[model samples]
Target: MKAMSPELASWLRGRTDDSVTVKRLHGDVSGRLFWRVFTGNGTHVLMDSGKIPVWPWIDIHELLRANGFRVPAIREIDTRRGWVLQEDLGSRRLLDVDDGQYMKLLDEASDIIVAMQRRLDGRTCADSIAGRRSFTPAFFMAELENTLETLFFRLLGVPMNELLELQREMRTLCESIDPSSVFVHRDFHSSNLMVVDGRLVMVDWQDARFGPPAYDIVSLVRDSYRDPGHVWEDRARKFTLAKGNMNMFQIARTACQRSLKATGTFSFHYRKTGDTRYLGYIPRTLRYLADYARICPQLDGLVRKTYRTLDKYHGEIDLRDFRSANIPEVRSR
Candidate 1:
């Protein structure tokens, strides 16, 4: 199917009186399509939602930019068809660049997130989808369980016994977490970051939440798209230490927890759609689990067991009609 529709064109023209040209580009990750548009004077990017629409991200991006975080501006929004025309933050994502360039850019991005944390002193965006929800242990557990069951059990065909035990342990671990609510960007990885004109611009921020500060940081350092080495981790550590003023123990704990959650997400994406690219991340994901286990010392058994289960089931997950799969659904409270 054509990415653009006549109605979409009319909508775009309505937003801008000047003559506009649209060029379709290819990117399929979130079940949506991206397009690069060129105008006489400038350029813009448009995203057309194919199956899984993320229209809310445009609003989130605008809110983050307004709060002094660097992000692409929303030029136009059409939620009816989930299409958005946004300022073209040049497409040189960190993963697209060499290690030296990527690390430097990530260090700068870390500065932005730190600034964002300072601004987030209980001051949430008034016009965001994630208003003032507290990231309590219960809420976090719900998210993990729901994503795991839907993405792993149903889509990956995980055995019932294994799914049950993992869910139980995950819930227990989540509940034991001490509460600290800071503004969180749910998916802050390398893919969602753009290097535009020597500046770092974050994108795909619809799933913003009020959570712990380490949430976004670990997501960046332990990113699956680009397996960064010790150099990036060291830079991230230094950045966090300077701004957050936390010790090694606390930072290590947070990183480990975040990495575990991220591994589940990567596995979910792969199993739900047969996307093997995410599988390449398993090794790194396991490494993160090991790191966390050594630090926590309590989750050692659970971590080792879960890792073995995932490894044993390493194969293509045939996820046909996932939405129709009648798995045990857990709604966020």
Candidate 2:
């Protein structure tokens, strides 16, 4: 365990009389640092966000809790300093569960999402959150552009003309989705879900915003961390349709959009932080995107073109060798 920073130590001293111990926790791709703090009373996690304010997290936490979702409790907060003391939800993530348990948990997760959506449906209080954040066509296209810049252009050295063509297609596809108002946890994958006392708890709520109802459910089933299999995907689809009254096309389209952005995010992380672990997930994410493309007629040409381009540069662009390359760093938020 590394020594606690003076600022954190001082903060702990002010709050507790017992001896305090702090240990650094494994960090996420967001680059935010977390420390597990122990005291005579109990254990807590402190998030150090550097320049980012903690108010959005605090606000979202309150919002989710009020809507009957399981989110971590905020024990203390220092808004100006970008630090938050929150309850320890344990280290067992949904990704750590077994096959049978995984399917069961996902079913429960689907139920929770349906209940939450129903609770917020047509409610005036939802208007406040919807006003602040949303998944507009512009936002969706920007994410696709991010992937094009990082993965296609920078990493693979794709031709500018081709990149532009794909960008246009992506923009069109993004614009096709109906801009329905619903709560969406932008990154509701297995890694962001913690299993505490047999209940699935959502974390990283800062990115929650208004988007299509199928967005979060697609993210949950077609996750990058674990392959939930075709059987599970079918089960999930049936459950979602029954619970939320959504159709297959709506879910598949959102999945395609989300998977493309996720692939770009993985490439961006590897390029920026010199971390190759993220590259391993790109192939699976691309497969998910391709699956959706096969089902959606509008995405056929773009997917075929992109796959052909990838095959053309197959031997040349090795993800393993990328770490040794002299690529310029481009940081993304």
Tell me the number of clashing residue pairs for each predicted model: 1, 0
Q: Judge candidate 2 against the unseen true structure and give its global Cα lDDT, from 0 to 1.
A: 0.76
Give a tens-digit lDDT track for model 2, residues 52-97: 7667777777877777778888887788888788899989999999
lDDT of 1 by residue, 106-185 (tens): 88877767877777656565446655555777766776776566545654557888878878777767765646666778
In model 2, what is the error at residue 123, expressed in angstroms? 3.8
Q: What lDDT does each candidate get?
A: 0.67, 0.76
Displacement of residue 228 (Cα, Å) in model 1 is: 1.8
Pairs clashing within candidate 2: none
Error of 1 at 128 (Å): 3.9
Top candidate when judged by lDDT against the true structure: 2
